[model samples]
Target: MAPISAIALLSFSLLSISISLILSSNIIEDLNLPPPPDFRSTILKNCKENPLIRYCNAVSGDISDVFKSTIVAQHLCNESKNPNCSNSFTKIDLSTRPLIAPLYLSFTFFWKYCPLTILTIDLSNNSLKGSFPSDILFCSQIQSLDLSYNGLIGEIPTDGFTNLTNLTFLNLSYNQFGESNILRLHYFARFNSSSFLRSGLLAKDRKFNVGSIVLQVFLLIFVVGIIGCFGWRCLQRPDLLPFFLQRKHKFTQAVLKAATDGFSEGNLVGRNKRVEIYKGILRDGSEGLIEIHRGKFSFESRRDFVEECRILVQLDHKNLVQVLGWCDNREFRAVAMRWTDGYTVVEWLSRNPQWKHRLKVLMRVVEAMCYLQDQWPQVGCEIRTSSIFLSNDHEPLISKLKVQDKNNPSKNVYKFGVFLLELVSNRSPHEGFETGETGFVEWIKIHYRHHVRKVIDERMKTTVITFVQVKQAIGIGLMCTDVSNNQQPSLHQISKMIDRVYQSSLVSQSATHRHKIQRTPTNALKVNGD
Candidate 1:
């Protein structure tokens, strides 16, 4: 009897050990133990199959799948946290991975948890192909997404990414997307982050081949620099000018008047808050615009015009409304910009029903604003949506809008954020509306406080303008137009906030749409002059 009992105990011990071994092996395989076969291939396969594997591989081998599963399951199982993520979800460090596909996929697969809220994907050295997937929108929780240095092709899908509502950083550089394609992505805050997408392939290739082009540019710059260095160079020695200045095909005002048919109202191209622009042709058949300001003319206004001309001369961005030259005769202070054949951003949005185009427009506007705020800090300007004009090609052009305070850079930045909110909300600036209130900000506050739906535009109610984006925009707008100017974000911080707001808005829209929450159209009146 004692021998039989001992045999049974030995058999039970062996069975228990076998079970433990199998469990350990399974955990190791799930956690991608014993080092990845090849980090790149592992990433690629996991991205194509299960993005969670990439996240799993990011951690140390000792960190078992049970731990990860526990955290993920905790968030998923808990009703309150399932909508978002628990505290443990925020601790995931996805920045270690070099590939974007896995990170992008992981974020998408477990979007409900917001697993990648603060992670950065640096796929800068990968050979990944195909267009950015619509599933990328699911990463609304991610703060930074870097897909630079990859072989991504095709136009970025502007409409599908309404899901990434929390993303603060985005980078898609050194790819095969052409000049036009790159221009299309100029609206997103991510594109303007650094020298990542500085020059397009077309521009770079042209610069490489055209040596004379470079020389000419350098010569022009050298002459300008030399003039700056020597006070008597160009300023004092006006008579000893270069041949280019000497050769002139100047046109008389009478000739310009005739070409424009006596400056007919029908020839008018645009009317800003300050000036009316008319299309005109010179005797040599060169076409341009002649601007005529209707408001009070003063010495300060003249100085403003000259200063604006100087700034315009220095500007070279594609999205900016180009200024060719200016004429300041005794009677008028006019500036001639490149003739834009399209309408304002508002008008363009009104006409185009496609969300893709609208998104492209929004991104372009944001990018242009960021460039202006960053590159030209001296302007100390804030862009008002009323100042943004669109050409016939539907390309957005950010005009020299309001200078909030030339001396106070902080004020300028604050106002700039407000302007961004205007674009996001499809509302006019504080002063753009003809209502009794000073601007949309005051009106929004009043409506918000009163719980009135009239604050929202009627046209946008039935459209794709989700409640989430609207709320997010309102929140951002409030933050930007905060009573305390000191709290306003810098250009970099504002860019990140804008990215986050955009991501959140997308997520909110997705959630609302997915849940089929039918939004009732509020009886709102058109506030701006159509």
Candidate 2:
């Protein structure tokens, strides 16, 4: 394994070169072409400092231009309904990437970023020089790949290529890839023998040497050992793999752009200024919402979003909004969610003016908070009605939940207390307090005790059931939000307390009505006598 200093030096050395040196022992320094005219440091920086790092420079001419073309093509393709649009949209045609410079293949880059939407890649005429790209193992969605008339070298990898089950068309002509029959790809059987005829099949036949075979076997083992070491480091500190490689489900920029109309202003329904929310309709006729967090791409931002996606995928709950997938490319980055038919808590309150109707919503929201506490503890503890959605079934779901810095149970309960205050009063949290920082529990302590009725929402038509329920719900909110205690009650305990208080409140309402009916029986007695 290399030391940190060695890795740094190697990183810089790789940065200096336009592409990775091919794995051939026979070096050809004489084949070097002159650098492009009017080259600037910014051009090099685009490749070197890119989120994909130097992989862009290693592949095609004018690294920035290549990324722009691909991203724009995604937008156009997402807009086009025609299946044959690929013939008209030519920038994404990998077949023509290198007219000026030798194309160094970006196996790793394409493998990591290519969504299922991309089906074909042709680098047939480019002067690409590299070993048979083993990185195509990640490109399982690709149905066609052409790499003919290139200066590629090395024996073709058989084991890795077997993953590309969808490959129906393949061409590898006029390349320097080795004719080692022992290393022939069995997966290539999907294509006819013509695919490899003028390429590796008839290229320079290697002399048989037992020592050379032994050397190759040892080298393979050595490479595997180094990879294992890096895998171990990745476990210790997760950033090593780059771009949060664990995120498997990805939406193409084209699909997202089409769904969002290139994130048009007309489709936008909500905005916090930090993030814009747009309504989207996918190609499959399903509807969704797109949350595009405003920011340019930084390595950390990309890593964080990918991490967020990974966590969102694991969480399954009726109260939590369903995350479909994510779209990330040079053009846009966002999280896609299944659109809800219901409104925000504020809007729902206006429509459902009955006190009893709102009480039912409060109970469901409590259950969701308790679940988050039990599963992730304090990680997603922040609560507000604005962050919640009422689905068509009248269930609540959480959205845009960020990772918290500290696991403060008291703070979470305090927010829940304010959420209760909002529901009981039919007012936003901002209206309850003069300042946002002041907890709602403190406002309750200062004002509400004997005059809880004064604070209950007057807009709602009060009933016997609701009057009792509001009193009990506020009581629970106050108790849960008490930060004076050295230790706080577990969310499980708080949830049960709400359940008991609510049931008793319902019983009180039923008993109150029963007594009222019994006292009014005189009229019925007189009617019976007549």
Candidate 3:
């Protein structure tokens, strides 16, 4: 019995050992299971290499908060701080966040921080400045990027942009890109060309072959030689040059009387309180308009008038009518202006109903105003549709006497805004409209927000015009005409705004034409004026 009991005890001990071994094996397996991967080290390594991170660290600024917050949100924080991992975000919108830094550094920041999941990054209106942020190409996973309303300059680098296979939307408008040749790049094929508005960049890729370059150099040398010889001849015998080119072409009273056929009633074209305008032909067969001041003046007053005429002639601009010279004789006090063959804006619009043509003319008029504002801020000139002439090719030319008003440039801004409304609505600023509005600007303001179709010209209704672009133009007009807003945009700013609208319309047209653009030497989208 003792032997049997000892055997039973040994069997029981073996059973206990087996159970313990099995449990220990299971515990060992559970302990051996691999832990989740920690991304903290990787993130730190990347941040260390990130130039923007280092820059922020050195400066001790809150700019790095964007990066730090991103890290925490991605569950890439230190284990002691936040144990539980959170779902990561796929977008980082820092638009209008008022970032003031070198633009390149911002690109570097985006490059290192943007993850594979990131789809959109907006860094617009940050007042960023510098060359184009080509470093943004490293963010290959991003599908949308907006860097508009910044002060970026230089040529847009086309390299590696195609690597962003997922990219779908891009906005680089209102920035200062030096060239617009990017429109020809295949990477930007899917994007809207209007994304380049207000860039002040013209689409022109001038590729000169070796042979063509050599030929151009030869022609340049030949032209220089001809000019040099002509200059030498002028120096030797000034009489050889035409009197008109030699100096201000002063015409005598007898010559003016004969040119105007003795100032006959048939020759008179217009008359105002200050002057009488008459068609005339100079001795050199040059046709022009003679403006004879109504009354004779004192010798001092005549001298001042002659000085003013000299300055007016010296004010050279493509949009301005050429001043031939002045007449300060006893019988008449007149000024000669070279005749330009074109009708006034009002007459021209009557013939051409196309919105593009009218917008082109308006652009030139604004440009001329900008030129006047920039080059001759002290010189005053009045602009009206009747006084604004569109040449046979639709180039706008301002025709009027130079008035002395230091405050006229600011006034011109308001006048141009009114002109925009006039050109768009086909209604005179002076004429009362059916909307019970006396002023054209007020009429446009009332209708542009909701009833814009009614505000636009009836002729433009038949044409294929983009309503958004028209609205943009009308909005600019409203901004300019707003008397309550003291911070009115300058003529230069207005010129750019109009140019943006014009370019946007051109893009829409080109897209409709199956993206076929007729390229010219100056610009691909420039109209008749250019």
Ranking by lDDT: 3, 2, 1
Please name the candidate that would achieve the greatest lDDT relative to the true structure. Answer: 3
In model 3, the runs with Cα more than 4 Å from the true position are 1-247, 272-274, 433-438, 462-465, 515-530
What is the per-residue lDDT of model 1 for residues 81-184, given as tens digits with 9 covering 90 to 100?
22333222332332334443353344333433233432433445466666664554544555666666767776666565445666666666666554443333
> RMSD of each candidate?
36.2, 30.1, 33.7
Encode model 3's per-residue lDDT on 314-387: one tens digit a residue.
Answer: 77888888888887865469889988888898897676457777779778888877776777766666678888
When 1 and 2 are scored with TM-score, the better candidate is 2
Residue 335, candidate 2: Cα error in Å is 0.3
Off by over 4 Å in 2: 1-248, 437-440, 463-465, 505-530
Candidate 3, poorest ten consecutive residues by summed lDDT: 5-14
Q: All models: lDDT?
A: 0.52, 0.61, 0.66
Q: What is the TM-score of each candidate against the true structure?
A: 0.40, 0.48, 0.49
Ranking by TM-score: 3, 2, 1
Q: Which lDDT tens digits does candidate 2 get at residues 172-263?
A: 87776666543244555456667765465532223323455778999999999989987765543332345656334476665666788888
What's the lDDT for residue 441 in model 3?
70
